[model samples]
Target: MDMSHIPDLITPAIPVFVITIIAEALWVKRQRAEAGVTLKGHTWKDTLASISMGLGSVAVGVGWKVVAFAGYAGLYHLTPLRMGSGPWAWVLLFFLEDLCYYAFHRVHHESRLFWASHVVHHSSQHYNLSTAVRQTWTPMTGWVFWVPLALLGFSPEMIVTQQAVSLLYQYWIHTEAIHRLPRPVEWLFNTPSHHRAHHASNAVYLDTNYAGILIIWDRLFGTFTPEVERPVYGLTKNLSTYNPVRIAFHEFAAIARDVARPGPLGQRLGYVFRNPAWKPKTAQAPEAPPPVEAAHPSP
Candidate 1:
């Protein structure tokens, strides 16, 4: 089936996103004011930086999507198996698509190469609705992760539609205002509380709660962690600049430098594929010289 007619799900929601951001910013401001707090949910400079990154992401993604959609469609045609677009099929696609996302999201955190792109969203020091828009400019390659869905007999439309849905569901969860919902709701879905832990750089929360729409995937896969307290948002070593280009490609450049360093092929590859925090092993520190001479002990 031709996937050209699949209306861009994200583009139409831009207005709603702008409105909701304004509303959430006001609410967060009022809440902090009433409580007499100094830190803000929406800072002028940070929000502007986030907006710049968001626009850059959209601009870059436009050209890339043409190639990506064609690839998805090409793969869909090769698969002999066909999944009909029925109500039950949509339900099945929901779980399958989210599971794909769970894998995509988790790997982006696990491997430094992918994390270079994924880290753009996590670059924010503040968790607000605007943070949701602070997407990666280098996300052109992310479509690779969802190619399996096309091969699994779903049309490009089905896969793209659900991917957009998962993304939309995640937007509201980026805020700090909602906190936890009812216990059952929190258990079933990816709540603000769970996502807060995901965004946190604290050691305990590192690499946890990687979810798109459902928290069940994280729980099932042993990556889930609850928000125990307020999270320290951003990377473990936060970026010092808000320049969109640096925010987008800093880690990629870091990987290049690490790979260029004098090392074995394996160690250099590790810099690309290993954890972002990974480093080559170093020699242990020499033990202090026998606690001085035996004559010194007598004194």
Candidate 2:
């Protein structure tokens, strides 16, 4: 199989994805029955929405890949380093590509514009295998983060192949099916527990664990948070609808509205580039102080 085409690596996995999702669905059913109550594990609407978003992501990636390949190839032609495709080169790229992904994933959470594209993955309230497939349709912009890899002598095809491997590694982490792996594996790699923390909307869990294949990046970057409490899955400001169209572009619409509000150019720019949680000073209200009794301790 030609590993140069990114979609080629993913298309063959489509059947595997479908079969695993079905297996997870059965597992979900068993979990509900064993608990003797309905739980927030999976629903037909949410699973369908996730699958739809996955398909949309694939379509967008296939179309946008040409643009990405051109940029990478252009830079690679000018690169001083000529990295070979030997096993050692692949090993070097495996780590470098994963590091690039860590940076990309972190930025996607930190920046509003990028978050608009990334929020689709986190929009689902359920934590299941299907949620892994719920990827962004606007992944074209994410290619910029890996430009350095190509310039450092890695071929565009090698980069794409390595990225596909990283993505496949992450797919299983989206499920609650596996509680935890062996301690060594859990510590060294991105496992379900680490990813669950990453997916959580819990106060302490938010904006943590941005690893792709290796958890060490998050640990080194101080973004690692353990699974201490049961995670509250989904976005902090959860969406009420399961419509795939809305799910894909709602944050983009929100960014437009926020930027169009009467504001200085700086504030408008901030709406696009600042953290997703950031707001203009004029839009933010002063926090009310705590009660007098709580603020001032009794002597």
Candidate 3:
């Protein structure tokens, strides 16, 4: 993958991101103070951890994108259908890429291996702008999911550009400041409300709302759950530490431990590939030979 030729949409928005986060932080602080409530949404430590993880993700993404580009470019070159770079192509990909994201995001939640990398985003309990920047360090595992676009004839550059656009679109939805948008906009696009449900640890919200830029994918796929009650953010089993290294690799460590346990090949494979909640069945203890000891003592 040629980095020079690839059009990056994320780097240009870094300044905008910093400005928005600061503005939102100040606004949140004021709102809480005015309401006679302590500021609980944003914390210095949480914000730092989020930014740390975001930086880590960016560093890893620079090198990891080579793998993504290779996978995408390989498929595109292999397929005979070459999609044009026309406006229609971009419009078609805008929707198609979002749909691909919906599927990829859904699998990341349902499969333990993918969740190992994804859990970094959900490590923070605070629902604020910084939380959106909290990203995983190991995104290479998901590079293959978007290769279908390449197979369908989209160029690697187009695929990567659309992906960055999608990532940028998702950044603003991390805030609790925007309660809801217009009804039509809410129904069509992935908004703060829909995303709150996605970040929520509540049982009803556990795996719902996997839309990227469009909420229509979730609505169409039956994964759309509205934010009714206040969302309880963070993982079902929240990590106690604020360390970025732990936040990034804790689930991966858990996966390793689970797969290393003594079990059949199939069971071990399931440990890595199955749901995060899945556990290996323990072996029953063997009964002791009680009579043999008694007989020897009597003799």
Candidate 4:
């Protein structure tokens, strides 16, 4: 586990961040304003949370690689997946990593244990390029979605490199700056149109479009929904507070609150691992709209 590659792994993300900021300033401003989407209330808080999560992610990647290398020491000496001269292997790794990401992402939405970490990314009401930087602070416990690659004997370096590329590719999809691409590109890739639907708070769009680089997984898995209308972006129950600490820990706090109520051990455990919007029998359900069309439509 050479820690040297960790820095290299994250360096590519810097340019993606730079390009996204430029795109936002030059293009997304009008779209955001036209859609009545403003980060004015949560910008600073989201920034802090994003920075915190970014730091934590670096640590997790490094630690995870160490464990991975140790686990496979006698079994296999992992090599970096390179795409320098001929890039077919690189391309294959990219798609493979994305395939894994689709699974990882879908489970994060469907399962409660993974949702605890993933919810931080979706907690922000305003969707923009910056929102893409708002990432998860914790290494999702019991949710090692990349294990399949390891089982197939892919080295830690290869896995990390592939993941970095997949993540870099996804950064561009975070913007409202880019609209529909030519014909089949929109149909194949995870375009801004598709991702906006994924971010929508609208019930029909909720928990759909979990693809990373490719939308085909969602299409195949039946999580796909075309962005036919404007998306109302935010959590079902909007967190009005701008405190990053509050935004990051709000769900955990709610889980704690639910667990404290009088109940059997099984019920308390169920409260922690059940679907995110789930409530105890004694708890009141939060009023929210049923599924409807997304607020932002494709042109």
Candidate 5:
């Protein structure tokens, strides 16, 4: 199988993504109109912001592809282990690539440096199909995660294309239009229900269900959290702007600020390597002298 010609599955899927997003928007609008239903349906500005971010990501990814292929091909040549280019190879790549995605997704959420890129997708407060296209400007971090597959004998082409397939498969799961599937399917796959929980900023939902295609990885890794209530989507401290530049670079600027603060080197590094929610303890001023207590603190 000549895998080099496996055209990007995502670029061609844009029209489908558009049509379905419009349909989901209308459906969600109607659903929200129903009695006792209170969905914060798609906002035009938010959707446009997502589209802008998606376009920026593609613009940057065009150049990144060469780096990715070269990185993978270089590794492939270093090893003698070669899996035959057959259907089985693709099947194996599918499962292995997903596990790689699980690791990539989990780490991006847990670490501030990576989260600075992945956060673009979750920047929207609305959970609609448009959110699926909200890609990152720094997608370079994503491909390197799968380079290990090349050393295991899969072609560089196969490694790249399979990653797109996993991403394309995940697009539809971003919509709130579809609810839960059958129990068995829900148990095995990453459904909208599961992904909704993953997108949620609710305390219980934070850092859970990091699956790309299969939910099994999250289940086995103890990151799975079922969606019980409708999720409150977006960051715990949501952004106030719709500017694409700000959306793409906000967290990075935040990391720069945190790292620049006067502190121990390890504490500064923590701002980059630690959880996005992690904060350094502030120095406390010594308590007022007992003599001052007689006057009581002025309000």
Candidate 6:
């Protein structure tokens, strides 16, 4: 397998990121001045944090590519899934990747280890196209989640290509500008409405809609929720500061604190990997009620 093409995978992501930022700035200015909607403008700290996350994503991709190449060289072959050669293959790969992503995403929310990285993405209180760029600095550690695809004999190139396409397909779905699409499309693909529900902090909305390009996985797995009611975006405990360092390391620091508590070995380990909301009995605090509608606007 030629490792040279690995750089190309990341190159396309750059333009998409740039274009999305440009569009977001123009839209945000309009949204704040004309519409009644309040825009959560960026601080330099958040911007730097977002850039750091992007760099982390690139690093993860590079590492994954190395693993993929080794897998191909030793056990598999490099066969690119050609676009336009077969529609069925494309459909199959699309749904398969979505299923994989669904499982990966759900576990990220459920498991503290994964959420430590994913939480950075959700630290933003606002939901806009730019929020999509606020990616994770720790997804590389979760690369094991995609090993099933390689075991199933997907060529390294095909796997990477399909994964890239799936991510690219998701970029446009990060906006509040577009509401519900046509019913048929909404039923099949994930749109802004579905993503908004995923990003929502509402009790009923958390850990829902863990799809990528296709939402069928969420529907099949019973994690799908409709966007009939508007969503309240961000985490349960919103981080008030726009400091990138705080945003990136908050969950990690919390995990460390939890792990430092007096407990049995198993319990101590569980505190770090069980779930983001997990609390040891001694350290447990009162559960706060979900934020009321009066406090925040619905997406």
User: Which candidate's lDDT is highest?
Assistant: 2
Each prediction's number of clashing residue pairs = 0, 0, 0, 10, 0, 0
How well is each residue in 46-93 modelled by candidate 4, as lDDT tens digits?
Answer: 555555655556566567656654554423345343233236656666
Model 5, 132-186: lDDT tens digits are 9999998866776887799899998788788889889898898776777999999
Worst 10 residues of 2 by lDDT: 1-10
Residue by residue across 80-184, what tens digits does model 3's lDDT show?
998889999999999999999998999999999999999899989999889999999999768877888999999999999999999999999999888889999
lDDT of 6 at 11: 56
Error of 1 at 157 (Å): 0.8
Poorest 10 consecutive residues by lDDT, candidate 5: 1-10
Clash pairs for candidate 4: 204-291, 229-295, 229-296, 229-297, 230-294, 230-295, 230-296, 230-297, 231-295, 231-296
What TM-score do all the candidates reach, one by one?
A: 0.92, 0.93, 0.91, 0.78, 0.91, 0.82
Give lDDT per model, in order. 0.86, 0.89, 0.88, 0.70, 0.88, 0.74
Candidate 1 shows a clash count of: 0
Number of the candidate with higher TM-score, 2 or 4? 2
List model 6 lDDT by residue over 1-299, tens digit each: 45675535555678778777677767777887887676454544555566666666666666666765575434444433233326676676666767888888899899997898889888776676667777775666555666666655565566677877877777778777787899999999899999988988988898899988888888888999988676877899988876666777789898888778777998889977897787667677778998877667769
Best by TM-score: 2
What lDDT does model 6 reach?
Answer: 0.74
RMSD of candidates 1 onward, in order: 3.1, 3.6, 6.8, 9.5, 4.9, 8.7
Off by over 4 Å in 3: 37-40, 281-299
Q: Sort every candidate by lDDT, greatest first.
A: 2, 3, 5, 1, 6, 4
Q: Write the per-residue lDDT of candidate 1 for residues 219-268, one digit (tens) a residue.
A: 89898999886689988888899788899899899999989999799999
Residue 165 in model 5: lDDT: 90
The true-versus-predicted C-alpha distance at residue 169 of model 4, in Å, is 0.9
